[model samples]
Target chain A: MLGIDWNFAGCGCGVPQGKDVEVGMRGLLVKDFRFALQNKKMMVMLVVIEAVFLVMQGAGSASFVMGYMMMGCGMLVLATITTDEYNKSMAFLMTLPVRRADYALEKYVFSFLCNLVGFFLAVVPYCVLRPDRVADTLYLAVVIMAVMLMLQMVMLPAQLKYGGERGRMVLLGVFAGGVLMFTWGRKVWERALAGSEGLQEFAARMAEGIKGLDAAVAGIGAVLLCIVCFVISLSVSRRIMEKKEF
Target chain B: MLVKMENVEKRYGDFTLQCSLEVREGYITGLIGANGAGKSTAFKAILGLIHTDAGRVEVLGKNREDFTAADKEELGVVLAESSFNGMLTIKDTAAIMEALYRKFDKDYFYDKCARYGLPVEKPLKDFSTGMNAKFKLLAAMSHEARLLVLDEPTVGLDSVVRRELLDEMRRYMEKDGRAILISSHISSDLEGLCDDLYFIQDGRIQFHEDTDVILSDYAILKVNQKQYGEMDKQYIEYRMKEPFGYALLTKQKQFYLDNYPGIAVEKGNIDDVMLMMTRAEREKKL
Candidate 1:
C-alpha cells in the first residue's frame, strides 16, 4: 500500500484530483526532462552555434539567439511527446499513476518552464553587450515570448491529437496556409485601395490608428491573447487526451 | 474483487472481444487463450487503455473511466507490445518511477536489476528482449500496486528466466492485498502459477474454472468408437474426434473413472483445456 493518500480531497469525479496528481505530474515532468537531457549533444550544438553567432555578430545577434532558443525550448516539448509515443510507448506510459489530464498539464507546465529558461538564457548577450537598450530589449523579448507561447499553445494540442509525424505535417500546412493568406490579403487590400479614394482614406486612417496604438496596451493585448489561446489549447489537449484510446 | 470486467466488449474492424472475468484480492488469475483470443483486449479494457464498446470495467472498486490518478496509483501494468521509451536508461527509468510512485522501491528495483544482470547505465534499446521483459515486470512490481494487469509478461524469455520471473510473481503475491491478472501463451507457466484460469476463445470466455479443479477434476477420456458411442455424454464439456476415435474433455473426471474402467483418462492441463475448449467444437462433429 505504499502509504498513498487515496482521499481525492473528497471529490470522487474526474481526474487531476488531490495531492497525488501533483506527485504524478512531477514524475511525468521528470521523465520528459530526462528525455530532453538525452539530447544533450543537440542542446550543446545549439549553444555552440549561438555562441559563434554572438561572437561574430555581437549584440545584434541577441534577438536571433533569443528566438532560436525559445523555439528550441518549445521543440523539446514535441520531442518528449514523440519519445513517449515512440514504439507505442504511450500505452505503457498511460498505465502509470498519472492521469491523461495530468500528462497534458505537465507538458504545458514543462513547456512554459523551458521557454522561461530559454528567455533568460537568450537575453544574456543583449544584457552584456548593449545594457543601454536593456529596457527596450526586455519589451521586445516579452512580445516574442508571447508569440512563442501562442506557438506552443498550437503545438501541444496538435502533437497530442495527431501525434508526431502527422502533427508536424499539420503544423507545416498551417504555416503555409497562413503565409498564403497574408500574401493574398495584402494584394487584395492594395487593389481595393487603388480602386477608390474613399478606401484609400479609410486605409490611411487605419494606418494612423495603428501608429497611434499604445505600446503597453498592445503588449498587454498580446499577453491576453496568448492567455486565451493557452486556455483554449489546454482545454482541447485535455479533451484529446481524455478521449485518446492509448 | 480488485478487477471486474462484466461482459466487457471491444470491437476492432473485424474482431470483437467480449469478456467477463474477475481478479480477487490475494489470488493470481490467469487468462489463457490462443493468439487473437482477446487476452490483450481484456487486459486493455481493464486498464482503461482502450474504450470498451459496452459493459463495465471496474478496477479497485471504481469504474475504470472514473479512476483518478490516485486510483490508478493502485494499478500496475505491462502491455504485451509496448514498454518505456527505448532512449531511456534503466537509471532514468528508476528515477521516473521514484517520482511517479510513492511506494516505488528504488532499492528493491536496483537489487532486482543487479540480480537479473541488467545494466543501470545502458539505454533500454541496447537490452535484449528477455532483459526488456524483465525490466517491464520489475517496473510494474516496483510501485507496490495492489493490482497488476499483465499481458504476456513472459512472452520473450528462456526457460530459466521465465521460471525466475514466475518466482518473482509468487513473491509479489505474498502481500495480503496484492493480486495479478496475467495472460501468457505458456500454459505450463499459468498452470503452475495461477490460482484460477479463464479460457478465452475468439473474444469470449468459453470456460472458467479453478486451477485446482482443472488439474484435479478435469480429464481427457480416450475411447474407441464403440466405447465413445456407449459412454455418457452428459459430463463432456468438449469433444474432439481423434484419428483413432474420440477424445472427450470432461470436468467430472471421477464420473468416467468410476464407470469406464477400460477407458484411458489422462489428467487435464491448461494446454489440454485450452485446446479442447477453444478448438474442439470446430474439430468435433457432434
Candidate 2:
C-alpha cells in the first residue's frame, strides 16, 4: 500500500526534470524488466509450468493433489524472491531514493502476495469444477499461507547470509528439502489419523472443537512466524551489509 | 557542525582504515584514495549505510547515531551502487520518493528528466550505463537534500558528462547551506572541485587540507645538476624515482617558493600530493 496520489506535478515535458530519489525508482523498474527479459527463456518456462500444474490440479479432487497445488505455488513465489539477484536488482535498488527498510519490507509483501495468488488460482478453479466440496478450498488457502510462510522463514536467512546467486542456491536447496520433509510429515500424520477409526469419528463429531482450536493456534502461529521471519531477515541483511567491504 | 568524523576506523583483516575528518558548513569535501584505499568504505560509514565499529560522525549538528528520521530526511545521498526498486517506472520512482521526504519537489524531478533528454516512459534498463548513471545523480540531487553524498559519480562517465554532473553539483553548492562529499579516483576533478580534500592510504586519512594551500605548498623542484647538492634535502618529501631525481611535495610550498626563488618550482596537483603522502605505504608493500 504505497499511498500514491497520481497527480503528475503539472506536465513539464519540455522543461528539465526534477531532482529526487522517486524518479530513480522508474529507472530501477525498467532495469528489472530488462533483467526479466534477459532470463526470458527460464521465466517463460516457469510460468508455463505453473499454469500447467494449476490446470491439472483443477481436475483432481484427491487431498494429496490439493496439498501439492498449495505447496507448489508457494515454491514458485519463493523463486521470485532471489531471482532479482540473478538480474542484479540489488545493486540498482541501493542507488535509488528508497531506504533499506522499505527494501526489506518488499520481500515480506512479495511473499504474501505470491501465496495469495497461488492459493486462489489453484483453489478457485478446483472449487468451480466441484461445487459440492468447495469448503476444502478454504482449508487449501490456509495451507497455502502456512507453506509460503514456512518456506520464507527457512529461505530468508539464507538469502541474507549468501546474497544474490549463492544465496538463491542455498535458499532453493533448503526450500526443496523443507517441502519434502513437511510433505512426508503431513502424509504420515494423515495416515496415522485415518488408521484410528475412533479418532476420525471423534474429529468429525467434534469438528467445532477443532475449528476454534485451529483458528486460535493457526492465527497466532502465522502472525508470530511472519513477524519473526521478517525481523530476522531485516537483522541478517543489515548485518551482512553493515561494515561489509562493499 | 556541518560534518565531522572522529577516530573513525574500519578493519579489513590485513589492512586498517583509520582517520579523523571534518567538513565546514559551506564547502565541498573530497575523499581521495587509490584502489583498495578504503574510500568507498569511509563513504558508507559517513552515510550510516554501514555501521562502524569505533568513532563518531556528526552531520548538520546531529551525531550520526542520534540523527532522527527527520534528520535523515534532510540528507540526500547517492552512493557508488543504487538503492531503488526495479519494477517501477521513472514516474513511479518519483512518487515513492515524494512520500519519503518533506522537501521532495516532483516538478523539479520531471523538469530535470526532460532537460536531460531522458525518456520518462522508458524503464532504466533501456538506458545505457552512462544514462543510468546520470539518472542516479538526478534522483539524488532533485531532492533539496541538505547534504549530498557522492561515491565516484564520475568513474564511468565521459569527460563531457562528468563535467555536466560536476556543474550541477557546483550549482547545488551555490546555496551555502548545502554541503557535498565527493569521492573520486580522477585527480583533476577533485583538484578543481573540492575546497578541502583528505588523502586516504591503506584505510587511513594520511593527509587533509585546503586545495590552495597544498597547491602553493608542494613544489616540484626542477634543479640543475650543480644545485642538487645545495638544495634543501629536508624540504624534499622524497624521490619520485631514482633516475628522474627528486620532487618536493610540501605543505610549506610558499617557504620554498620564497626562499629558493631561483630554483624552478612546479605546482603539485592532487595526484602528485597523494603520491608524495602515500609513497611510504606503497613502497613498504613493494
RMSD for all candidates, in order, please: 4.0, 8.2
Per-residue alpha-carbon lDDT of candidate 2 for residues B141-252, written as tens digits (9 for 90 to 100): 8868888888877768889988988998899899868788889888899888999888887788878888877776766676665567686667566554434454555556
- Chain A TM per prediction: 0.87, 0.55
For residues A1-246, write the lDDT of model 2, one tens digit per residue. Answer: 122212212111111123332333333334333433444565445445545665676545435555555555455433544554534555444434434433444455555655675566556656776688777667666765676676676665566557656877876787689899999999997898889998788767788766668676877887777666666665554444432333
Q: Give the runs in model 2 whose Cα sits over 4 Å from its true position.
A: A1-106, A126-130, A171-246, B81-89, B241-244, B280-286
- Residue-level lDDT tens digits of model 1 in B64-170: 87777777778888888899899999999999988888888999999999999999999999999999999999989988899988899998899999999999999
Instruction: Give the CAPRI rating of model 1.
Output: medium
Runs in model 1 deviating more than 4 A are A1-15, A195-199
| Clashing residue pairs in candidate 1 (N, C-alpha, C atoms within 3 angstroms) | none
Docking quality tier of model 2: incorrect
Q: What is the two-chain DockQ of model 1? A: 0.61
Q: Give residue B63's lDDT in candidate 2 (0 to 100).
A: 73
